[model samples]
Target: MNLQVLQQLGMSERDITLYLALFQLGPSSIRDIASHTGINRGTTYEALKQMAARGLISYAPKGKRRFFRAEEPDKLLELAEEKRASLEQTIDSLKTEIIPGLHHLKPEFSSGNVRFYEGDDGIEFVLKDILATVGKLEEKTYSVFSTKSIRHHLYRPFPNYTAQRIKQKINVRVIALGEGGEDAEYSERKWLKTDGQVDASYIAIYPPKVAMISMASENYPVATVIESPDIARAQQVVFEALWRFL
Candidate 1:
């Protein structure tokens, strides 16, 4: 079957082949297993040693020969569960030790400092930051969107993200070109038409900063975020005027 899945489940390719070979041939020596799997003799020996260590295989010494055989496949589940438990314990210890230390290692920058976020993860981070920060500052947010970059991203669950944003009771005002109406599924509190002025523009104006995002090709989504009080106030006035009329 799929070797990657077996690898992810903690089996090396050689171990996987050796286990399957053992299952097929009952009990066999290293040379027979190597011939069956096409793995070199040294590699087959190593795989057998590892499998034996993990309790997936056992060897019985008869006279001068050692025969290797597979243990019950049900032991794989037990081994996997043991690993999970060990991982959980390690995670708990790290959380207790590391998370408290994070407070001491504070960032060198101040809050409301302009941060440029690019691409899908960057976009998601900015949106989540807005929801957390602006949700307390402004009751509403206005959005001007283009469909170019967003149409191709497979990053997050889109509808779920929109639903969560709306659930926060943060109002959204939208100014869009013709195609924008069809793409943005989040219902706008206010909708304005752009009259086809710009090419592939995405803009969001928050209290502290104004961000413009555009994707030239499918790959890089560039965002320019500015944190100037003068510029933000000017943009706010412009948005209010557009909101009042449209």
Candidate 2:
């Protein structure tokens, strides 16, 4: 069975090894469990102590020593629930306490911030951020500079992106760098002719932030997000001028 979920629940490799060993060894002393798992006695004891603390393993008195055994696997659900509760409380503290305290850390003139993302998961984050950022705006519209070369690749990470955009009532204006893009609700498109497919890149001009996505290699995508109102505004101005000319 895949016990990888134990790692997600904060169990180290040694802890898992020991916990599983206890099931095989049946209520084992720390020394026997350590010998079975090939871990040192001290480390195995500490790991078992932590597991006991997490309620993943239970110990009982046996003669002069304690014997350890894995709790029923059902305890994993309890552990997961506890983790979720802790995360929710942490979220509350971040919003109500930590973030307010962190405001003083910002400089008088904040410089542009840039972040990089790679692969499908990273691309999904950028796309979700776009919808979230634009949705919070007084103007729920943004512009895109898309190339045919990368057009197919852009939404692969977020196939339902347009659906989400429309659901959120967010609109997009596109300056397609080459032919072939579809029309959708709350969107306008204009094409820019090129000799052929140039470099595969896409740029989105969202106020206060800009996202640039491109192909690093065949079927490989990378993205960069620049959080700067000035840069976003500059790109908007250029896009508007070209939009009118087109």
Candidate 3:
């Protein structure tokens, strides 16, 4: 009476009952099948016709009435195998259609462009890119002003990154906003008190190619990096002027 297997083979509840009755009772007319399953004659005929079309049953005329019998149960395995073959053919056709387009999707190696990355991962990408760009420079200087959220995320990863930056001998002059008030731990430990104090804007110079200017907040965390020689010179002049006084 475990008709769950038949139900899974695309048999409806009434269809399962009729098919199980036919399966158990052997070759029989729709009337006898209906009586055996207690299904109405109309529903029994419908289920019988559908099962016949699916190769689940075979029927032929015997005298004045049609007699129906369940086809070999092995047809269920054949149906599954046929579906598998159809799926494999579909997958192979798609592979042929898509593989050639992959080469066209490849980027040209010499092409340089500004790309926008989204969300927290974008922020991480920009920050990590800054680290890589600075690591190759002979000298690096930055005046960074950060908001609370940026400060929190920075603190989480700062220890390891700070160690890496220090080993590179990349001098970073940070100027972060004293947003969480005067005696913040990030300000005391990371900020250079006199030369590198907290401010409302961020400025950083890593010799040759990069500088990050970030204004971080809950709603608008904008980190902009200027990679032009002329702008780098302008920032350096401003940073040096501020560095000299402090």
RMSD, every candidate, angstroms: 6.6, 5.2, 12.6
Against the hidden reference, what TM-scores do the models get? 0.60, 0.64, 0.40
- Which digits, one per residue and each the tens of the lDDT, describe model 1 over residues 1-246? 564566756897667878889999999998899999999989899879988998889999977879999999898788778888999998997788777677457553446356776777776766675566557774566544444335344224233556666687666666554443443434464444455555556677776667777765667666667666577788888877876786
Per-residue error for 124 in candidate 2, Å, reads 9.0
lDDT of 3 by residue, 56-168 (tens): 98999999999999888788888778877988998897778666576467554222322443444555666667678766655553444343435544424334655565565
Ten contiguous residues minimizing lDDT sum, candidate 3: 184-193
Q: Which ten residues in a row have the lowest lDDT in candidate 2?
A: 103-112
TM-score of 3: 0.40
The true-versus-predicted C-alpha distance at residue 197 of model 3, in Å, is 18
Q: Using TM-score, give the best candidate's number.
A: 2
Cα distance off (Å), candidate 2, residue 216: 13
Give the Cα error of residue 138 in candidate 2, in Å: 6.2
Off by over 4 Å in 2: 72-74, 100-104, 113-132, 135-140, 145-170, 176-186, 191-203, 210-226, 230-246
Expressed as tens digits, the lDDT of each residue in 8-52 for candidate 2 is 789877777787887788988988988888899898888888888
Better of 1 and 2 by TM-score: 2
- lDDT winner among the candidates? 2
RMSD of 1: 6.6
Q: What is the lDDT of residue 17 in candidate 2?
A: 79
